[model samples]
Target: MAKSVENQVEQTKVLPQYVAALVANLLVASVGCAMSWTSPTLLKMDSGETDIPASSDEKSWIGSLTPLGAVFSPFLAGYTADRWGRKTTLIATACPVIVGWVLIACAEPARSIPLIYVGRIIHGLCLGVAFTVIPMYCGEIAEDKVRGALGSFLQIFVSLGSLSQYAVGPYVSYLVLTIFSATVPFLFAVTMWFIPESPYQHVMAGEEQKALEALQWLRGTSVEAVKEELAIIKENVREKMENKSTPRDLISTKASVTALYLSMGLLGLQIFTGIDAILFYCQDIFAASGGDLDSSVSTIIVGMVMLLASACTPFIVESLGRRILLLISAAGMAVSLALIGTFFHLLNNNSDTSSIGWLPVVSLVIYMIVFSIGFGPVPWAVMGELFAPNVKSMASSIATSFCWFLAFLVTNFFPTISKELGSDYAFWIFGIFAVVAFVSVFFLLPETKGKSLQEIQAILGG
Candidate 1:
């Protein structure tokens, strides 16, 4: 027993796949940085920090257009991931982001709102593609023992990048911030070249030897051990191909229907909870709360809380299970958001809000922490695990696209909601959704922790 435990530890210590997952997720971090760009930059622009001044409507366009790009980019990502392979697809996704950053760097100095808008749209396209491709790639490449942890890397790095941006963006000039953002993807593209392609992608492309080599490299195991894992991957791939699924087939089958429902529900949970809109306008939300603290500093602190919370999941997910974490997350989010709303409710009513000025900041920090624990990362982590190999790309693309569409709606309209309906009401609406998320996870979400893709499918009745 001791020897076996020791060997397992030894195996874990050398798992190359985890490293590969980390490297790929650097690009995801770049996406996170890009997504959070509006938070500080918008504030600067509104204050006339830039050469070109933007109106309220133009700022909305800059903030919301990324999801618009997300709405359309997933089809391209899905096609490319399967046809060209995962490594190439990730490398390709960087191009648009890099270009977007370059445009932003130029646009900042020129005060060119048009260039900035175009840059934001292009980055949004990259964001959409990254969301679609990286989860699938990470899910395919990781061994079952470490899959949960590695898959969660997507969110960890995302949170890290977000924190990095939040910490730095407020203090930097617009051109410097844009230039810094552009450097991340350039680094990601260069580093990713050293990692192997997903073995699953190679298998799907009928390159058995290449698949084996990838498996060998990823597993860092003996040939025989690698072969056994490869056989399982190939068999799963073969079975999925035999049942080859389409958009039509996904609905024709009970398994696929369940998978789609779960995917969509999880994606919906991620957005409707108001994280994207809140993050996009973090400084504004803080400013509106009438807090004594500097809104920029508070936003940075919230970003730090999010980063720390996300960092905890990979270690605990397999033990505590997905359903419980998600339930806990949703419930916590509901409470925090409600408290935040109450804070605003009292303040708006001209109640003595001075003593309770701390409430909004504390509540938001709790909200960010809870959200980071589950909704922020788990949905994307679980996405690639839910579908069979044949339909994974297609289903994920659809779900990601849908997720972004909801994001576009929420982000574009949030200011309107907060203004006309009151910020308290906007938060209350998100709390209501959080409560619904709790119920949904309790009844519908199956635990995929520590399970293989085939096993997960069987659990979902696929």
Candidate 2:
């Protein structure tokens, strides 16, 4: 018994697929850095620290540009992943991501607003591609038992990236931070080059031998040990690829349409939770609340809580299932947002709010904890799990692009809403939407724990 336990530990020490998942997500982390860069740096830009004259309106545009750019990359990413395979397409994204960061880095020296805007647009474009491909690649490579855990890694790395920026960006010079962020994707590309392609993609292209080899490596087993699994993968791919699916096919059948609606619905709920607005403007939110801790320090605390919660979600989802977690998350978020809105209302009224100055920080921390565990990650995982393989790439691209499009709207308008309509109303609107999200998840979402892809298809068919 001791010998068996020791061997299990030894096997885990060299998990090549886990290695592949982590390295690929390093690029996702870079996207997270791009997504939240404005959190710490936007204030400095408005102060003329970067020598780029960005007024409040320009700052809004700057914060919104990444999501805007992300909305466009899905079409190209879906095409590239289908054509060149997932590994190659992921590696190719690094160049534009690096270039985007470099443009922002150069903006400080040239004092050019256009350079920064161009750089943010480039970042958004790559953000869309990463969101489209990473979940599919991770889902394709993971074992059935470990799939939820592995799928959650995408969100974990994103939290890691956001935490890295939240912790470091406030303390470092803007140029230095952008330069450091640029290196993450380059490292992702170099490390990703050494990993094997997804066996599913290999099978789709009729490269059975290559698929066998790749599966063997990913499974940490001998060729014969993986052959049965390889055959299953081959059959599944063969079934999915019997004919290509068209755009109209996405809405043609009940099952396909159901999957699409559920996927898009979760994303919609997630967006209306005002997650992007909160993330992009986190520090500013704390600053406005007159918190006890320094705004930067409070922001770091929020980041830490978010990262820890995200890291815990893999295990939690495995044990509890996805739909329940979403239910819990939406309910918790509603209460937290209402608390924050109340605090802001008191502040806006010039009422004595010093006693509850802690409310915003506490409320945001709760909000982060809940959001990290469920809506932040589950929707992306479920999106990959829902579609038939032939339409998986295309459906994911549409859902991902739409997710970012909603993010663009929220982030771009959040500050304007806070300024023009009072921050209290902004928080209240998000709180109300959280209530709506709770209702939607309870009525519509399905449990996906421990199910095979074929089983999931059947469930959606019902």
Q: Judged by TM-score, which candidate is best?
A: 2
- Which stretches in model 1 have alpha-carbon errors above 4 Å? 1-15, 221-225, 381-390, 443-462
TM-score of each: 0.90, 0.92
Output the TM-score of candidate 1: 0.90
Local distance difference test, candidate 1: 0.85
Give the per-residue lDDT digits (tens) of candidate 2, residues 356-388. 878899999999999998888888777777887
Against the true structure, candidate 2 has what lDDT? Answer: 0.86
**Candidate 1: tens digits of C-alpha lDDT, residues 229-340:** 6788999888867977668867766677898999899989889999999888888888888798998889989998888888887776656777887898899999999999
* Collision pairs in model 1: 52-111
CA lDDT, every model vs. true structure: 0.85, 0.86
